[model samples]
Target: MEKKMTSGKLELVAAKKFAPYGEMYKVVDFLNKTLKDKQVIFGLTKDEKGQMTLSIYET
Candidate 1:
């Protein structure tokens, strides 16, 4: 069985071909400053309302 994720925790997912979720260019720039990878990392997380949200970061 799969384990349940803790509240407020982030889970990483592959985002090789997809652009960042919001403001593609700006998100890339923000990530580039902290990470030096060509591929972007997508994160799955739950919001306060228990809705799933996707977040992006540079690997």
Candidate 2:
């Protein structure tokens, strides 16, 4: 699954081949690092219902 977070909303793209596992953390970490380096605002995580959520913020 791939996701971009914006304005409290998560835009996600999932590939059937990719299984959700420890990879999820990797994705989140990657996004966080990229956003920080680019000075962009974003967030990534699973919601209370265990659903993946990506949120982007105005920078």
Best by lDDT: 2
TM per candidate: 0.31, 0.41
| Alpha-carbon local distance difference test for all models | 0.45, 0.51
| Global Cα lDDT for candidate 1 | 0.45
- Residue-level lDDT of model 2, residues 4-44, one tens digit each, is 34434433333123223556667667777777765454455
Q: Provide the lDDT at 8 for model 2.
A: 41
Show how many residue pairs clash in every candidate, following the order shown: 0, 6
Superposition TM-score, candidate 2 onto the true structure: 0.41
Q: Give one digit per residue, the lDDT tens place, for model 1 in 1-59.
A: 12333334433333233322445555545665656565555445444654544455433
